[model samples]
Target: MSSQETEVLVVGAGQAGVAMSQHLTERGIPHLVLERDRIAERWRTGRWDSLVANGPAWHDRFPGLEFDDVEPNAFAPKERVADYFEAYAKKYNAPIRTGVEVTSVRRKDGESGFRVETSDGTVNARYVVAATGPFQKPVIPAVVPDTQGLAQIHSSAYHNPQQLPDGAVLVVGAGSSGVQIAEELQRSGRQVFLSVGPHDRPPRQYRGKDFCWWLGVLGKWEMAAPPKGAEHVTIAVSGANGGHTVDFRALAAAGITLVGRTNSFNNGTMHFASDLGRNIAAGDANYLSVLDEADLYIARNGLDFPEEPEARVLGDNPACVTKPLLELDLGAAGVTSIVWATGFAVDYSWLQVDDAIDAEGRPRHQRGVSTEPGIYFLGLPWQSRRGSSFIWGVWHDAGYVADQITIQRGYAAHVADVPLRQAATSAQSHTELSERIAVTQGA
Candidate 1:
């Protein structure tokens, strides 16, 4: 196999890796990015066909580039997002090698750098940034039993309603992905059952502003952690059909049955927790809390946004919640498919650097700086803040990680004059908008 050398080697050419390359390039740092597939491979192949970005184009995009040709307020489709990443990489001429998968990364023996082994060849680099992102492995709960003929798929593998087998479909998990998939399947004439779980229900728009805009302005996105009792609650909002709220009651009204969380699958029967009412109530409380926060922000600043009366309405309980089903026999219910909208897990088996990761195989870092020198991580959820996993947030994190690399490489003077975060701020189209985002890094 062929071998190569570089100052820095970045794995995964997704948003995080590309963003790292962009920052490294800005600093005149010599780096090469490797990807197992095409640029933005996850967006191209891992998402559902009807999926769109959760955040508006204006808010969730890289600095120096708006989503290409898409409206600022609109949530670009999956394809558009992938296209935008490809375009962004091209604009900077990022040194990316697609289809080259990094199989192992370890510190070189008696050396200060890493010996990177890839599917194609090997790479020796002084620094390595593992930008594989948060969604490395899709996880289905172990409680899901093996069925003889029932079809099941993780949300990442789901393309559209037609991708599943015919007949009723049971969707487990009530996060953004699960609710969106359930709604889509329901709309496509499939009887859908959505398992309710701890979730945050924020309206897509309140008053005259999108929920994302509210989150940013209210400093919600910059929060270090989720609120108390909501550590695992997923945000249940969507950017489909221009944008809309993901109200469980509203979804139930539209013919999607809402059930409690799937507890287990035994003897060909699916068990459910008796927390449907409690879960919905918790989500409703969160929904109200967001509106209350937004209201408080507007009140304090005396903003001129109008009140949205309809958003305050909490309708009657849905049939499923009122008459909760303790157990479900999929065969009898005619449930032919099960879509697991459960989230993902990280895989760091390839990274053999000591002290870089914890006992649980999770990266041990403050921001993106790992405990191990010359090693770094990017694109982790809450890596710096609540927004770290976001598009723009990842860009900022990449900048921070790049700065750390520059400092370690004895090139501090090269970036001493201007910080990359400030540079990105200066490159923004709107000064007010750029100023609103909390800075994740400094020189």
Candidate 2:
């Protein structure tokens, strides 16, 4: 119905888009951020009712907007976190248009910019950022369509255990969502049979510190790549809350049936591969490896952090006997619901540009910088490094991505010459920090 033009257009006003806008606004960059829903819509609607940030509020703060006035150690719930984003969008009065869904993003042939077709209007921008989300569409197995007579609900739509039919529930997937939801369901007195998969079962508290603290201090957050061969092991923290270890052992001990990975559901029967023992063992090994890495980092960095009692291991759980399940007769089990905790899928079907997408169907980019002249992506897991998808991680990427847009437009460098990661990684940065600390102590 109407038209608009801007130097840059950012899609999705979530953590990534808001962070990007924060930097762009500081530089006097002309940009418009469009959100199909409210800011942090995913957090508001997609997560469970009791969902809290898996990490501490202190570590999850966006740059310049640290967790002030909020409990630093408390794991902020979904509403609190969503409100934080809303407050952020309002604090700076970010140039965000909510409820504006972009239907298509295509290169403007003969023109250098892109044409963004939105529910409100069309926008022409020199730079287009695909910051929609890392968690977009929920990916359910194809065989799930054969789940006749069973109430099928993906974790995205699952708010509480009461919402499902009162009977045994099968949580399909062993990632954070699946584990957390299954825990909740079982706690709600529902028999939750968890379909196990390759998962990272790191301890929530390691050496008397939150796992995140170890990750932060050890610079483990900087290493942002999916676990080798387990790309499904997202760079997610271990717990549903910022406290306690959550593993198959823990879940299994809590009276939940731990089954093998789901193969398919056909003819009223759900089939599984007998990799339960193997997966559990592998997860346990990876967990130890992770702790060892953190331990190594602490020792090598000469940190004098105190250690607590030894953390518990899944091996000790007697209920964690991983016998493979080949088939689950949904009718026989009287399973009234199947919660698909099978993570989300990214869709770039709207990104209408050739050579812009990589062979893996991901935006061809290195550290948020796209292969295309003016196209960029933000909020991607591992966009810059391991922490890219996390709240703190977005700030670093937003600065870099915004600077790339502004600098190309011949705007004065409003962004810092040295990026956050570089500053953290550079020897000069360490020297500067040491000097500052020394001077402060001297003063």
Give the TM-scores of the predictions, in the order they appear: 0.91, 0.87
What TM-score does prediction 2 earn?
Answer: 0.87
Local distance difference test, per candidate?
0.87, 0.77
| Lowest-sum lDDT 10-residue window in model 1 | 432-441
Tens-place lDDT per residue, model 1, 161-185, is 8888899999999888998899899
For model 2, how big is the CA root-mean-square deviation? 7.3
Q: Tell how far residue 406 is off in model 2, in angstroms.
A: 2.9
Residue-by-residue lDDT tens digits, candidate 2, 183-241 = 88998898878888777776677765777777677676787676577766633244454
Error of 2 at 68 (Å): 4.1
Of candidate 2, the 10-residue stretch with the lowest lDDT total is 420-429
User: lDDT of candidate 1 vs native?
Assistant: 0.87
Best lDDT goes to which candidate?
1
What residue pairs are clashing in model 1?
none
Model 1 / residue 134 / CA error / Å: 1.1
